[model samples]
Target: MNKPPRKKNPTFGIAVFIVVAVLLVIATLFYNAIKEKREFDSQNPDTQSISSDAASTAAAKPASGAAQ
Candidate 1:
């Protein structure tokens, strides 16, 4: 009696490799974004206060440059 040969799925391996690469890229981007945001926030601890002060100053000033 003769035996039949088994078939292999080559696409499965390629698909798995693609998925893993995509996941790694996404994770790297997420990590970098979080790190940058943390660094920015730390450097500007009083962001809210500075923004509020700027808003108040702008509001107090005249919108036009004409003399009173």
Candidate 2:
């Protein structure tokens, strides 16, 4: 008696592996860009939040000693 050979599936192959790798790289780049933007915004304060009195006092610190 003779034996028969086994058949392979067409759907399971290397094409799927390459697609997954490309998606992972794009996600990492976007994450790093957003993190840096948050840090930059935190370092700078909004002008509207500071009161008029405090703003004037800060501007006069150097002139106060010289005029008197």
Candidate 3:
């Protein structure tokens, strides 16, 4: 009986492996990002300070055209 032909090159298998690895990396990064966001929202004081500082700066700024 005749045997079926075997794949001559390994490039296809390597390409598929690389693609899957990249996708897994991307998914991990996105998951970490979401987790960090949730943690930040739960209450770190640094975030509060930043927001307060921004509000203070906004309040201190002069209104447009008032100096003219």
Candidate 4:
């Protein structure tokens, strides 16, 4: 027999593991950001108030700007 025994390559497995690990890390960060955003929105009522104030000002701005 002249053929040498074949050795298994680990590069593909290692690459797959790294890819999955990176995906998990990215998912975790995305989930944490979403959780934080939800918490912020739930805790802050001022944003809603500010939006309402802006709406009022927006309505007044056009009228105030249109002078005779």
**Number of colliding residue pairs in each model:** 0, 0, 0, 0
lDDT of 3 by residue, 1-68 (tens): 99999867799889999999999999999999999988888866456566888989989998797885
Q: Which is superior by lDDT, 1 or 4?
A: 1
Local distance difference test, each candidate: 0.92, 0.75, 0.88, 0.88
Q: Residue-wise lDDT of candidate 2 within 1-68, one digit each (tens)? A: 78787686656656677778888888999999999877867886453345876888888788656865
Which runs of model 2 end up more than 4 angstroms from their true locations? 1-12, 46-68
Give TM per candidate: 0.61, 0.46, 0.55, 0.61
Best-fitting candidate, scored by lDDT: 1
lDDT measured at residue 28 in model 3 versus the true structure, 0 to 100: 100
| Candidate 1: tens digits of C-alpha lDDT, residues 1-68 | 78788787999999999999999999999999999999999999877776899999999998797688
List runs of model 4 lying over 4 Å from the truth.
1-7, 48-60, 63-68
- Cα TM-score of candidate 2: 0.46
Better of 2 and 4 by TM-score: 4
